[model samples]
Target: MLVLLPPSETKAPGGDGDPLDLAALSWPELTDVRAGLVEALVELAGDLPAARAALGLSPTQDDEVARNAELLGAPTMPALARYTGVLYDALDVRSLTRAQRARADRRLAVGSALFGVVRATDRIPAYRLSAGSALPGRPTLRALWRPTLGPLLAAVDELVVDLRSSAYAALAPVPGAVTLDVLCERPDGTRVVVSHSNKAHKGRVARLLATTTGEPGDVVRLRALLRRAGFHVEHPGGTALTLVVPADWATR
Candidate 1:
């Protein structure tokens, strides 16, 4: 099974691995587009004010732009190790056993604006670019990615679990992939879509899915696996599952 994860805005800086090699990344077909974006970003970085404006950064986030400037020369690390945030924090990949980490490397692929999609083991450098950002002299990133990325993702043979946030998902959509939603159940039986803690729940679910020996080929098996992992999973509709948490889930 393949799990598509969203890339985090905040990434762990520096790495021990060699600099990123586009030819060595998972999708060689995306190299041209990747090279294009890298050139655009590198050029933009020469003008910090323009780069900052293009990346939607404030004064404090200038470091992010600097990171972009050094994207080509910076040391790299596995994509899974590079990303960080509430979701990744919950994933806690650093704590996984060797076998589990191997499984994660095989099953996970992160949606990226600059690289298209990177496998868990793909080497990447610390850089700042959001799927929503419009680089100078380029069409929308969605436009740039959709032509190549969509076909590539749509061709995946495994049951794909798409957990990307809307922006990244907009870049490339896996046809018929099961999308998950985390909801909060109130005492009165009404359910509200989880906002703050949703990433954490998705992260946990991803960790469970990643570590398991079972391969869930469809929504049914996927639901079963999540339930087995102690999550309150419900099939709400077509190709979608809702993981319900208590209303006070965040506090807990």
Candidate 2:
């Protein structure tokens, strides 16, 4: 099974691995596109104002632009370790057992704007880019990625659990991939879509799937597995699963 995760805006810096190598990444077919995007970012970084406007960053985030400027020569780290935020914090990869870490390396992949996607163990440098960012003189990221990434994801034979946000998911949607929705059930019998705390829940779900001995090939088994793990899972048909949390535990 392969679990697709969204890339985080915040990343850990100063890796011990060698500089970026497009060929060494998981999907060799994406090397050309990755290289193009990387080059575009580097050029954009030369103009700090344009980079800040394009990336929706403030003056305080100048360091992010600097990171992009050094993308090509920056040190690299595992994709899993490079990403940090609410989701990665909840995944807490640092605490996993050695064997669990190996399983995570195999089962998890993160959706990226610059790289398309990277396996958990893929060594990558920290770079500033987002799915919505529009690089000058380049096609829209969705336009650039969908044709290549869609086919690749569609061709995956194993079960795919997509936990990407709408922005990243639109870049390359996996056909028949099981998606999850988080909701908060209020005492009034009404359920509201979760927003703030959603990533934490998804991170926990990804962790459970990554470490489990059982492999769920389809939605049925996947639902059962999550249910057994104490999640309040609901199947609303199709390839979607809804995880309900009590309103009291919900974040606005």
lDDT of 1 by residue, 1-252 (tens): 999999999999889999879999998999999999998998999998889888999989999988988989999999999999889988899999999999999999899999999999999999999988978888999999999999999999889999999899999888899999888889999988755678988899889988999998899988998998899999977899989999889643
Q: Score residue 215 of candidate 2 by CA lDDT.
A: 96
**The best candidate in terms of TM-score:** 2
Best by lDDT: 2
Write out the backbone clash pairs for model 2: none
Count steric clashes of candidate 1.
0
List candidate 2 stretches off by more than 4 Å: none
lDDT tens string, model 2, 1-252? 999999999999999999999999998999889999999999999999999999989999999999999999999999999999888887888999999988999999999999999999999999999999998778999999998999999999999999999999999999899999988888998998766668888888999998998999999999999999999999999999999988887752
